[model samples]
Target: MNLHLLLADDDIDDCDFFKEAIDEIGQLTLSILNDGVELMNFLLAEPANRPNLIFLDLNMPKKSGMECMEEIKSINKLKDIPIIIYSTSLDRTVVNHLYEMGAHHYIQKPGEFSNIKKVVEKAISLFTSTNSQLRSKEQFIIYP
Candidate 1:
């Protein structure tokens, strides 16, 4: 399958690294959004071209990823699309909240390029292997 992925993050270097990893991973198309506001605009404007998955960063300018996720979940048109929290924070409290709020999965951003690939691959694998949109809380967080 040709997976269409959307990633929303503010850091230019992280976006570059993620794009590189996706290229290496292959079998997928990716869209990179610079901030939360841009991500919302892209999603809202392109209902016909919805992504298979969204990898969202928590700390972003304009609006936070948390805000985006909340908004995405509230809308009937976008709620069912799987959201993977792709963030640098390992704050357990926040992770728990995201899981409760219907985020499909959580990934604590790894420091190394190889680990980024690993975590991204793991998230995709989960999507392919399961029919359910949400995973068990025990399995919510992907460890790098």
Candidate 2:
């Protein structure tokens, strides 16, 4: 089964860049959500379309990453799926708060395209390995 990823960020270019990076490194499908509400709705309402992982961005207009992370973790059904916070800022306080709130990982957005490419590759590697470990232990594919 192919890996699937969901990106929850308001920036269309970032989403596009991420998708391109994913295509560069591995075989993965991607979906983009422009806001927290959209992200939550996609996960909650469309159970059939849930992705293996979600990449959330902080400081959005309406619903923020913190709020979305809280909501996602609180839900019994959605809590199992990993959520990573991807933001431009490197504020330690925000990172710690997100970690406390139950984000799987925190990745600071890169300014340079080369850096973004490297980061994206590493992100996919980590995410895939973690999920693979889980599935291997369970003797079943976790994300498809």
Candidate 3:
């Protein structure tokens, strides 16, 4: 099945790497937004094009990922869309907070291209599986 994935990140290189990894995986469509404001606008404006999954960066311009998460979750129509926290930081406090705030998963940005591909593929597979269920905090992070 084809999965529509949306990424909200400020770093161009990270965005490029993510796109490349998704391309390698195939059968996925990706749309990227550079900042939290743009991400929220896109999501709010196009209800018909809501993605199956969203990858959000913690630190972003205009608004932070935490703020975006709060807004998204507050909206009834957008609340069910799965959101994955994709970031370079691995702070336990932040990760825990995100999980509490309803992020579906957390992925630490991998240093290697192959690792990036592996994590992305794993996330997609887990989300698309027939028996897939929202994981508990103990099982939230997806490691490469």
Q: What is the TM-score of each candidate against the true structure?
A: 0.97, 0.85, 0.96
Rank by lDDT, highest first. 1, 3, 2
Evaluated with lDDT, which candidate comes out highest?
1
lDDT of 1 by residue, 31-143 (tens): 99999999999998978778999999999999999999999999999999899999988898999999989999999989999999999999999998897565799889997
Candidate 2's residue-wise lDDT over 1-144, tens digit each? Answer: 477889999988888888787777667888988998888888998787998888889977689988988898899999888776788786878777776676767778876667777866666666766552232212211121
lDDT of 2 at 21: 76
Between the candidate structures 1 and 3, which one is better when assessed by lDDT?
1
Error of 2 at 92 (Å): 0.5
- By TM-score, the candidates rank as 1, 3, 2
Off by over 4 Å in 3: 130-133
Q: Is candidate 2 or candidate 3 better by TM-score?
A: 3
Clash pairs (backbone) in predicted model 3: none
Query: Can you list the residue pairs that collide in candidate 2?
Result: none
Better of 1 and 3 by TM-score: 1
